[model samples]
Target: MTTDAYDHAAVCELLGAWAVHALPPSEQHAIPRHLADCADCAAEAERLRETVRLLDGPDAPTAAAEPGTAARNEPNPMVMSEPTPATRNAALARILAVRPPAPRTAPHAEPYAAAVAALRALLAELDPQPDGGPDLAAWRTPVIHDWTVQDTVAHLIAADEHLAAHLGLPANHPQDPQGAAAPGDTDWRTAWDTRTHRVIAHERTRPPTATVATWRAQASALLACPAANDPELAARAATLVGVRLPVAEHFLIRAFETWIHADDIGRALGRPVPPPPAAHLWRLVRLAVRILGLALGPTAEPVALTVTDAARSTEWILGAEGEPVRAELVLDPVDFCLLMGGRLAPEAVPRAALGDEAAVRTVLGRAARLAWL
Candidate 1:
């Protein structure tokens, strides 16, 4: 049998984690040998050890006292000591112990039907004041990377139409000769009568807040998506989290996108932003599960998890007892969408939220901002 090299990061993380907290003897013995020859792992172990000491020492009296129970909730360190035959077998069995691939998430209740109604109401109520009050006509037309409010609105309508078509519902507008829908035509077979008013107003007004109108349309279109009708209802719901989502994930993403972006639009319009309902929050958490799956795809081991959003920065973390996380930009739904949509830059992410910079860069490469048609 051939022996493969252990990951240096894993070795260091385990060493560091073990120093602060006891490891199973199996892990404790193996890591010392791995670290003895690995300068990188050794260095990391030193840092983690020092850091843990600080937390467990007088400098962190309060922290140290809190976990004074001395019983760490963590797994045995022996599992990580060395990838020995027995340990490897144990690890493999543990890995396979994970439940089968997650099925798509589906809506537990009638999903935001009221949100759709509200969108239609807002759409009808919307009337872009073409008067250009606070005007922006001199500016260039918004494109994929740099979207003006008008361009954003047009894209929103386009996105709605696309969703409508996918659902096998009547689209608000078919692809025209110039490949453009008339500003006011909104006769999609889906429940979109009121959307026309909003779209027409957006086309005419061309203001900064029109982006809000566009976002509103997007929410409505998602509710009306055809995939929501798929027999594999779970696969149908997952897409809301991303460009390609399964069903269960789809509704959760829908809830997140609608509630979050709607809040953004409210912030722009000076409207009181209602907080997302509790159900919406639950959906976002489910969406988080999908993110974990994506981030941990290449990883073979289980990873402990922590997710942070420097106010909507990235998405999740899923790995093992001590592997570099499967994901960096996964912990937060808001940041995940922004990063995926090219709305935020990598530099905008705070330091604490990222696990491995390379992993984030990889996610970025996979999902770039999309251009409007």
Candidate 2:
């Protein structure tokens, strides 16, 4: 109802649309006044606004040349015209000039940097203001689990904290107040979940913008760390999140999870987020395949896993080696990554398979199980 006595649940349902300015004028005007007196609504609104800011990128004209350059009556090709390659390049250059792209890093760390930048661009679309700032009221939109959009971001701060500390960056928020984990508590999942719950709860008390700032700041610091820039530095292995791997591989894991969660957030907002760049997508595919192989272990029955894209097809033998391949499975690069990310059900994901269904199902099942996101 577009009135002061609005049903809270109904109003909450509209927050996503409201944040994007999709509601009618009467509803738009009423929601803000309603927010003013409702503390819960106000906090949720603020969080949505902050999430919107992350979606924004520098502005550039979509079409047409400088003002007055086009003749008034003559058919102006620039009007409603697709930009030429040169024009597109120029626009991209301008965007970079206004807001520089992610920092350069070693090959292993490149995807993480790019994914971070991509998420920032995606989040900007929530509620872009005329002044080029974001002010959406959509943060309360449900994403994964019971987490709202704001909570998803706060979870990221918690998720990335382990890697951040591994890289020698200081933790932005203090440890969960529940208690110092028992000395013998070696379960990374329990620890990870605890910290995420704590961080999300803590972040809920503050403006959504503050939580975003903390997440972005920590990410920037991680990118700036020497390990991110130096292949040798990142080569040193350290166990984090229950896996022992080189820091470089861990960086790729970060990129993988960030992209996955960003996609989740986009889905919650009714936006279709594109997959990561081709090269980056492939890197994720390879890493996921390797991890899936490990999870399947060396003694299990082998499956011929082939990941293909427009440019090339790469194959791997998963499970035990000496025996003839029992099955051949083919997947699109993105589909494979999504499967590993746990975004797609193994049975539901598109694929081409030949040979034993049991072996195929095994690979798919293992891949889905690997999804911790």
Candidate 3:
């Protein structure tokens, strides 16, 4: 048995033996002394014992059992726990390094990339109408300050190309706007906005011949970006505000933009524009709710979401208008997407779905109050 120099984890393990009457006095006596002095060790002991009890109880386990047996009061051969500080500090260090994901009850994230890929393929297959092509007439909107589908396609492709320049694109990329003569070209905003609209006009005049094929390739490629797999990935210091994001995230956000634009044109064109599959829809809504929370702040309580079709539920906790976001509601995948896209109404959302009602509305902000379809 060790003395005062024992590590916390070993001490915790020893205490388990003592509770069950297996730890010898050499290790056992120090445990009581340590627990008396160390709050962290005591809490850990309590949690571990609770874990073992839950795991070993008769109603819980189907397998041959262990841990419930009485302890042999011998000086345990198992190393004595050195009740010390390293135990907690080590765990904290690992947490800080990995920034591990919080526990999630869902089986898997909705597959956004796959959904985008399918949309891309569908866009590719549409045969143009006899009037030279699928006319842009269906996309024109009378609304104030919103983008159309044509403008969307152009923007997604062009904006990424432009920002990719500072993030490591080749000098010959198509994002270079200023044809060497635009005023205040040095201001990145002026250059990007001017060139973005210019490209939008140019692409509108000569839309991509294999629109779907181009999008499919674009969407599929985004899955391989560095940011998607690594949480610690940070954008280059030189990037602009909206531009400081990973490529996979960028692709998904673009998918949101694309889908919204699709709805816009579809409403005008009078045709059904189905959203992505069940899984991807969940991720889309999940991302939107999270970003909205981050952009704003945490609400008082949790908000619940229910996807009408898949029956998947999500929960989010947002603070105030400008505070960090928390997942306080469980929502349905499809409904969540519709809610965020300037479409579905708040009244349509299942209030009971969110465990906390008052906090939900506050976090959703004006987006929840709109009366659109």
User: Which residue runs does candidate 2 get wrong by more than 4 Å?
Assistant: 1-101, 127-136, 177-186
The best candidate in terms of TM-score: 2
Q: Would you list the rank order by lDDT, best first?
A: 2, 3, 1
Each prediction's TM-score against the native? Answer: 0.41, 0.72, 0.47
Candidate 2 lDDT tens digits, 283-337: 8888888888989998878899999988989999999989889999999999999
lDDT of 2: 0.72
* Clashes, model 1: 36
For candidate 2, the C-alpha RMSD (Å) to the true structure equals: 12.8
Sort order, TM-score high to low: 2, 3, 1
TM-score of 1: 0.41
User: Residues 298-353, candidate 1, lDDT per residue (tens digit)?
Assistant: 55343333344344333333444456544444335445445444455656633343
Query: What does the lDDT read for residue 279 in candidate 1?
Result: 47
